[model samples]
Target: MEQRTHRSEVMLSESFMYDGVIIALIISVANNLYDLGVLDLANEFILILIIWYGIIEHFIRNSNVINFDIRYRLLFYTTLLGGAALNTIVYKTYGISYIPIIIAPMIITLLVDYEFGASAGLILSLSTAFHHHDFFMFLHLFPQVFISTYLLKNTKNRIQVAKAGLISGIVSLVMILLQEPVRHFYFSMRDYIVIFLNPIFSSIAVVGILPYIEITTRIYSNIGLAEIATINHPLLKTLSLHAPGTYQHSLRVAELAEHAAESIGANSVLVRACALYHDIGKIRNPEFFVENLKSPEENPHNTLPPDVSKNIIMKHVTDGIEIARKNRLPIQIELAIPQ
Candidate 1:
């Protein structure tokens, strides 16, 4: 056990080192691309350090709430890097107003939670704003980031995502109007369209790519959970056909668990999804379980010795685990099976 613990510590140190190298590369590339002076580069590095500290602090504080594993770290950095790159490209090509500032925050919020999303938004907004010396752009984007993340909380459908985007766009339009001096400012229709539609377009793009991100990362959003928890899912359908009693029981458990989870401010969608699949192992020998047994006379336990019956019943946990793994369910659902 001591040796295993030491190995785990070494692996963790190596992962942090790897993350540091990636962050250094990102900073160097971004600074050079922007042709930032020494002071600006230093400021950017400081911002990166602050963001890094926040990530570590969040993981430490919320260890029980989230698994801050290598995969999650990768997801965080990938979103940051993607947002930075896109922001740079768009800012240089089109302009600052056209940059999709909400993409990183929205995606992070959907995949993880709003807190991380908010943090990510802060870093991206500050970095971009500082780079361009556009505090006004930062002011415009920062609130939109928070609003978009807030609106996207517990998102269960694509339409909700679009709605969040529309609302964010409206907020952006208001910000634009507020910033400009109405008496002196004259705006073209093109400017109005760009300011009003940027968030909406960015949101539509996020919706289009969200499924691919979920599939690739195996880190699902509530939308993905909603999809998998539907009656049409092959595993759920199989459970319903082969173990109707277990299926019905699962549905009831899901309903109860969902309500309980919601009351506790937990991820009710995820809880419900896990509950629906928790009994899938019983499908292997439906009659062995009392719930699936059509009658008391059909109880397999009565015919078997106590030890054998206990083993059969206990095997469901392992069976459920195997089935969950075979189906490539989310890690949360897979972990819930044994529990």
Candidate 2:
């Protein structure tokens, strides 16, 4: 009940903020469009893209959490503007070069969701396409974006994130492939340097910011990461203390799930997170599991039929989620528990 109230309050407070941001950004776009002269379709599209991205970002993705914390707000807005800014920089400085702007979106996609990242990428690309006054190149940008980002999903480690430079590089290559057979867009080797290498190097360097963000914010980013080390979290120590067997089970599950995710190209962070919570229900009945008790204690379920025992066992998933929610765990962590 307390948990549900907290959820309701958070929702009510954020409801206005999210609606307000969208409404404000829409007006801002209209104002900017009118001031810039409503003659050009390209400019009109950029305004539309901004609003669309704003709506999707704040209303859909971010509507879940409604706090006024500066760190995360900065994360959201920076990612929004950053994508557009990068695209503009790449296109203006080096013609037809999109790698510069895509650098941020690739990482943002991994840390966040493909939907948000995709919106960011589109807004940035379309912003550049319109701003540069090239409708053809602008409209044709989606192919590379789709192929590149899709392949990069399920990245859950530093090495992979650091290696996202590879993603951008591959995107550039895909863009090149899409442009096939006699499109001499860049002037020379130096221009190609910006076109090809900027995204690769930028992606690698840009991911470094994530750790700094994590450190300063102490937020998990829904990527299954947190600033809390082993000693910092109680559940880990409790698992080590009174529930060693459950601890071992969790470890095994984490290991297996992680491997399965890696093998099948699933989000390894999400899989590992689920493994951590898979047995949280057991915390309510630690001794019921064989390892916790020296003498087989009387099964409390002896008082009830198998159906009742099953209900009790199944209730832990909801119980664990409640505890997690009370602690303000990320939705990703909450998702780790069974439905």
Candidate 3:
């Protein structure tokens, strides 16, 4: 019952935040269009709002990506709103900007996952097309964005991220050349450089900013996860020293859960991380548990009444919560400690 209530509170909080983001997106888009001198303000705004809500409901909420931590949800909306706003300002000034399609999609893919990133790519591409009334732009941009998101889904390092960006750039270059083969024949070095360097530079920026984003948002990239999984982590080392049996149990559970998650097509990173830290509370009273008992005579629970033993065993869960909170563990890891 407690767990259910906690889950309900989390859901409600997320729902409220979700609604707020949706409102922000609407306001940002509507203001952009207004600044661009959109005619028929009432009808156009209403139509756009309806369409935006439908897309978000279908692609975000229904797809289950909205259930991610609130920080990630905020990231997604910020990327979308900021990208749209930038695209609008650039289009009003120059003609086009690849910021929305290239850089934004890359970050989303690496931070969130490929599926949500791809969804954002498509939605943003379509929104760009509608905003500019250039359907061809949609055809030109979607493929590159999709390719970047799909390719970078497994990236674990900066080099890999850059490689994915370059690959996506190559795809974009091919699409550009195919659209007008005759124009490239007369194109100067400056034109070629401008077109080709966009993706590469955008990719570099993504890699540079990723660490800052991870720090601020408390979201772990694959690189961040690897860093924590090492024995040198403070909490893990303490667990090994104070509760060796629990440490070994966690290791075995992590190994088995990792394999099972991989076999069933679940997120192995999440499952393994949870398994590794689930019994961290046992460190608080190592000698009280049977798994850590040094001898039959050393079993402390044997001298206690049934009720007292049960309460003592239950205390580990609360102790784990305290430890996890103190260490500032990820919410997923903390949640798994009880189970």
Highest-scoring model, TM-score: 1
lDDT of 2 by residue, 107-128 (tens): 5565555655665566655655
TM-score for each predicted model, relative to the true structure: 0.86, 0.58, 0.80
Give the higher-TM-score candidate: 1 or 2.
Answer: 1
Using TM-score as the yardstick, the better of models 1 and 3 is 1
lDDT (Cα atoms) of all candidates against the true structure:
0.81, 0.58, 0.70
User: Tens-digit lDDT track for model 3 on 146-218?
Assistant: 8878878766567887787788778767766776654334555664565566677878888888777766665
Q: Write the per-residue lDDT of candidate 1 for residues 1-339, one digit (tens) a residue.
A: 999989986786676656655674585467347575777777777776667665644453455533544566678678878887888788888876688989988998898877878777887777788776778778888888889999998888999989989999999888878888843336677877897899999899989888888778777889988888877899999999889999999999999999999999988899999999998899898888888777899897988999999999999899999998788887667778888
Candidates by TM-score, descending order: 1, 3, 2
Off by over 4 Å in 1: 1-28, 34-39, 54-56, 63-65, 68-70, 182-187, 303-307
